[model samples]
Structure formats: C-alpha cells, structure tokens
Target: MQCPLPRIAVLWSALLFGLALSAGTTPALAQAERCPKLVAGNPFLQRLAPRTVPAAYVAPRQVGLTYIGHSTFLIETAGGVTVATDYNDYVRPAMVPRVATMNRAHSTHYSLNPDPGIEHVLKGWREDRDPVHYDLDIDDLWVGNLQTNIRDWRGDTIRNGNSIFVFRAADLCIAHLGHLHHTLTHDDIGALGRLDVVLAPVDGSYTLDIDGMIEVLKSLEAPVVIPMHYFNESTLENFLTRFAGRDYAIERRESPELVLSRETLPRKPTVIVLPPGG
Candidate 1:
C-alpha cells in the first residue's frame, strides 16, 4: 500500500489548513487536541454496536473524508488505507485509493478503467443475475455493500444494479448510497443495521425523488447526513428546503474535507453541506 508522495502531501496540507480554520484561539493546540492520539475503538460507537461485544471498550480509530465532486469521496483510515466511493473518470482523488467502489447506474458513478495501483476494486453490480456482494477488510478498515436496483438507459428496470457501500472503521458505520433509484424496503433496512453517517444522492429527479430520499433518510435515522450528486445550487437548496421545520439541522462548510471520530459527532441529526473538492 504505497501511496504516491504528492498525494500524501496534498492531503496533509489540506488537513492542516482545516485545522487552522477551527474556532480556537490557539490553532496549533486546538488542532492537536481535536486530532486525538492513536487509539483502538471510539467509545461513542458503543451506542450503535450490536449486543455481541463485551462491556469494556477501547478508543476507536480516527478517519477522514474528502469530497471529490459528484459522488466520489476519499475515505482514509487511521491505518493509512484509503477507499474511494462511487469512483468514476470525471472525478478521482489525488491519491490512488487502496480500494474503489463502483455503481454503474450512470457514467459518472463508475469507471471502466480503474488504475492498476488500486488494491481492491469492488463493483456494485454484475451482468449475471446474482447479486453483487462485497465484504472486504483492508487493514483495520472493513468495507461491504448492499444490493439495489437502477433504471437502464431506456428506462427499463435493472434489478440489483446499484449498491449502498458501507464502511465500518473507527467504530462507526458510514454508508454511501450510490445512484439509488428507489427507497429501501424492510429487508434493506434490516441488512443495513445502523449507520452513523450517510452520503446520499440529492439530485431528486435522477435518483429517487426528493420526497422518496427524505423518506429513506427518515428510515435510517443516521446521526450525520451529507448531500451529494446535486448539480446546481437550486437543486441543493430545494433539497435543503424540504428539511425545513424538521428534526434535522443544516450546516454548510467551506471545505470539502472533514475528519470524524465518534467523540466529535453531533448530538442531533444534522445535514452537512461540504464544498465539492479538497
């Protein structure tokens, strides 16, 4: 897992810049404090864990997420392994990801020729009738996906054509809804278990309608939801407007990247709008 030096430098610079912008009087100390030392499992994640674990807990790992325009996001784990979700030709992270997840609902959601440097390439769909399934562990990071359907170019129904990629690391379960065309059924929800964060498509017309996406969000009830796949400000605003007077709070950020740990998660359900790139 040797990452290109230029890519590592770029990510480090962006991270330091974000740290400088924090609302603390001493930026250096603030950054140091917010960036916790290496730990095992996040304590806050215990709340969402299944009943199988023991009562004691270790500190969770820290992970960073960077929006790379459209539906592509770079997810970096504390162990240094990285994953790109909904990878396509139009947008890609500067660094070659250790793993890449793809959904072929549209040209923008997948790439036919992924880089050879990537260790694992997970496709959300398959030409065969069998469902696309993935359960991969890249170091401490665990990645999986749930099958979903999509509409073909001729608007014909294609079953099990899309996937909602789930990343479990740092003691948190983060889900990316890739080109989702419909709402989740009882079984879909059951398979998803619990999601701490969700990256959702908000194009309204292209994927599920705004109302349907809203319903899907309500069903998951994740602590943090990030909007993606929207084309213009109007589309984004329309999606945000629908959440008005609801239990969700909206916050627009100037940067495309953010680091997250269970300890830093918001207490309430919040919609965070991140800029399009690092």
Candidate 2:
C-alpha cells in the first residue's frame, strides 16, 4: 500500500512556493548565490584575510600575555609566535619570548642581553646607520617595523629610533605605537593600513601629549585602543575624560591579552584597560 504524504510537509512546501512567488527568486538559486566564496585569488576573498588561518597554523588554547610594567607588552600569538615590545626587566619570568624589540630611548626601553631562548632580537637604532625597515615573516607571525624618534630628559630634541611593530595573525592586525613623539605624516598613514587594535602610550610625557595622542587615534581610527605608559590612575582618568562626548566604551578585561576575529570586533571605538596582574 502507498503511504500518504505528511500534512506538515505539504503545508511547508506550499508556504515555500508562495514565498518564492512573492520574492521572484527560487530557493535553490538564492541559496547557491548566498554561499560564501572561499577562493584565495578572488577580490572578495581579501576581506576573508582577517579570518583565515592556514592549516599549519596552530591556534593556541590560551593566548599568553604579561603586562611588563610601563610601556612593555609580551604577546604570544596563537601559532606559538612570541612578540615582546620594548623588551625590559619588568616582564614576567614565565614568558620566554622568541622575538623581542628594543628602543634605545631609556634604560627601561632596552635590555642588552635577554634570555638565550630568544632567537630574533630587533633593535630600533643601528650605529651610524640609516633608518631600516624590517619585515619578519615566520610560520604564522608577520611583523613590520618603522623607525621614529622622541625627546630626551635634558629638554633637547633627540633622534632615537622607535619601532612601530605590526603583528598580523588570527585575521586581525595589531599595531604597537612605540614612543610616537610626533604627528603621523600622510605617508605614514598610508603605510599603516586598517588596524583592528592599537597599543598606544598615553603618558603624555615621553610620547605625544594628550591632544597629540587624540589626533593620532582620530587619524588611525582603530576599532580598539589599549593605553599604556601611564603611571597612576589620575593619568588614565585624564585620558579617559577627553572621550566624554565620543561614543567610546571603556572595558576592563580580566587579562591583558584579548582574542578576536573580524566578526567579533565592536562597531564603535573602545578603550580596553589591562590592569596589573591581568
């Protein structure tokens, strides 16, 4: 004996037919067109660059980071790539970084001999040498650096090389603005493309002042900004006060390290505070 068609199936088929007639498109055609493109050579695929990680790339279960007091930060990327900015003594003893950057402005900025485990050590300045632009590409880490300068303690303008390190991983571009004492030129802006997150020095003493820093942020317009170099709460408060009218949200994360992707970023500007021990 032939079985009868289910009542619910018949009703659903009729509803779908009616919707298709109203929309002027077949369900199969619409579904086929809506499917995401995965080819690497397509122009549309560039947008996916921030989301695609190579199969060889190993995602870390926990992204390790330690806020080595002052302007130093140690970031271990998902692929076991270690990056240390302004390598100093304040870093946690547990983190044995593979790569480190040193700026020659102050004692806190540079350490002559770091751990023996560190394979790649990049110095911002070279003796009697012209400015160098370095591009480092390991298995899963991409770092680019540009040299800049800041003033010294003697009230005299000094030419010290600073590295603006950019790390690209897990479909996000993170930049560390090291002791940026001057405004970014148009060329500088062009070189540094869309930034998902930015680590900036807000102390206003060594780096750019409050107003200058604000201008830099406005020009860059990164989605997330993490302020560093401030000594006390009052300094941070002063920096936060400037964004009263702005729609920037301040979020205090339990840890200094944040994992993110293209789909998880905020629409408006956000300030993330990473307190000590975080």
Candidate 3:
C-alpha cells in the first residue's frame, strides 16, 4: 500500500505551487542586497538568538531548530515534538531530543551509548535488513531510509548505510539526504514523491562532489535548498558558485532560525544561509 502524504506535505505543495505561479509574473528580488560577504564568524556564532514572539497579525507558531555543530540538528515542531539527526560528538551529550537518528558511516554520526532520556533511537544502517520506515504522528513527521554507503578518503568502499530522512512539518516536505554518495535514481525520486526543501551536504568531499551535488539537486526540483556539512566560509562560497546565474535568491539571515508559512515561502529555489545558531 502507498503511504499517504503527510498533511504538511500537502499544504506545502499547494502553497509552493501557488507562489511559484504568482512569482513568475514578477521580477526576481533578493532578500537583502547588502548581505555581508561570506566570512567565517567566531565561535560565538553558536549562541542562540534572543527570541521575540511574532505579532498576533502573523500566525503564532512555535517551530524551533538548534544546530548541534556539524550536520547534527535538533528540531522541535510546533506541536512540541522533538526530532534529532546525526546525533554524535560532544554536542550530543548536551541535546535531549525526543527522537534521535544516527548513521553508521562515521563516528561523528552515531553515539556509542544512546542517550537514556531519549524515547526513540533509530539506527539508519543495518547489515541485512531493508530500509526502516517510520510514521511520526505527534507532529506528522514521516521518515524513510534507503540503503547506501559512503566512501572514505582513500576511496575504499565503506560498508555503511545512509538514511535519507523526509520530514513533513509546517507546510513543508523537507528531505535530508544523509551522507549520500551517488546521484539519485528514478526510483529514488519516486520514493521521495514531492520535495519542497532539501538538506544536502555540499562539502564536495564527504558527500557527492560539487557537480554531482548540483545534478542531484536539479533532479529533486526542491523549491528551497539548504547546504550543510561544509566548514567555514570557503566551502560555502565554492558551493554557491555552481548556481551563479540561476533564478535563485540567497539570504544570509542574521539569525539561524526562520519562520516560514504557506504564504511566506518564495516562488523560485532559494538558498538560505542559516547562521550557526539557527
């Protein structure tokens, strides 16, 4: 039986399609023309920004995301459901997520001893099992995994499984292609269905190379793309160069977190640079 699309996915698809058609008539606009040029800020960039409640005129939403260094992220949906990805490193000890996802490719991606407080712990890599399937009801976050391996620096075949997580939340169907090493095939797109946002690694080393990454992104046709797994400024600059003339908007927000709704999403594919804390 085919799984039903999550409510958030349906809402996001309708909103993105409507906005795309409307935005096609108007000229492209940048979020801010004077965004600071690419520069690596200090470690102080890790502090969370002061929270300001949005006005009543805007919908009251409570989605929260915390960056736990590297590719690890802690996301709390508006419904108070918390989900974490690639929970490892010293930072993992600091996070107390309701659900945690870990991949077996690198030590940084999985914790040796799982957190005792976490209710759910998912291991993305398995030796003989098929992909793991999960349907989260608290916030309607649906996640599915595919069996894939990563290559080490020496180009040796490392037997590991990378989980491609699909999160349906807040009118957005976002896919996190965790440690993907090859271009996506036709079946992969079919499995993904419709993707509005894609979290991809653009380091051009651990994940696919620059050109390979661009190809995969094009095939997915996600309206928004967030690049991760790159260190400092130089890596981000090299990744953006691939889409120099594309009809894309680059936004470097002073804060890492953004509040997006059906009406607020952009028409074309947007690249949002979330500062460290976001």
Candidate 2 segments exceeding 4 Å error: 1-66
TM-score of 3: 0.72
What is the per-residue lDDT of model 3 for residues 41-146, given as tens digits with 9 covering 90 to 100? 2123213222233223334333455555567776666545567788775445254777888876778788888778888787766655333445443433334444
lDDT of 3: 0.60
Model 2 clashes, total count: 1
Residue-pair clashes per candidate, as listed? 4, 1, 1
* Superposed model 3: Cα runs more than 4 Å off: 1-63, 93-95, 128-130, 152-154, 158-160
Model 1: residue 156 alpha-carbon error in angstroms = 1.7
Cα shift from native, residue 207, model 2 (Å):
1.4
Model 1, 3-119: lDDT tens per residue?
A: 244665564455445434432111121111111111124454334443322112223456788899899998877667678999889899998888999998888988999999998
Ten-residue stretch with the least lDDT total in model 2: 31-40
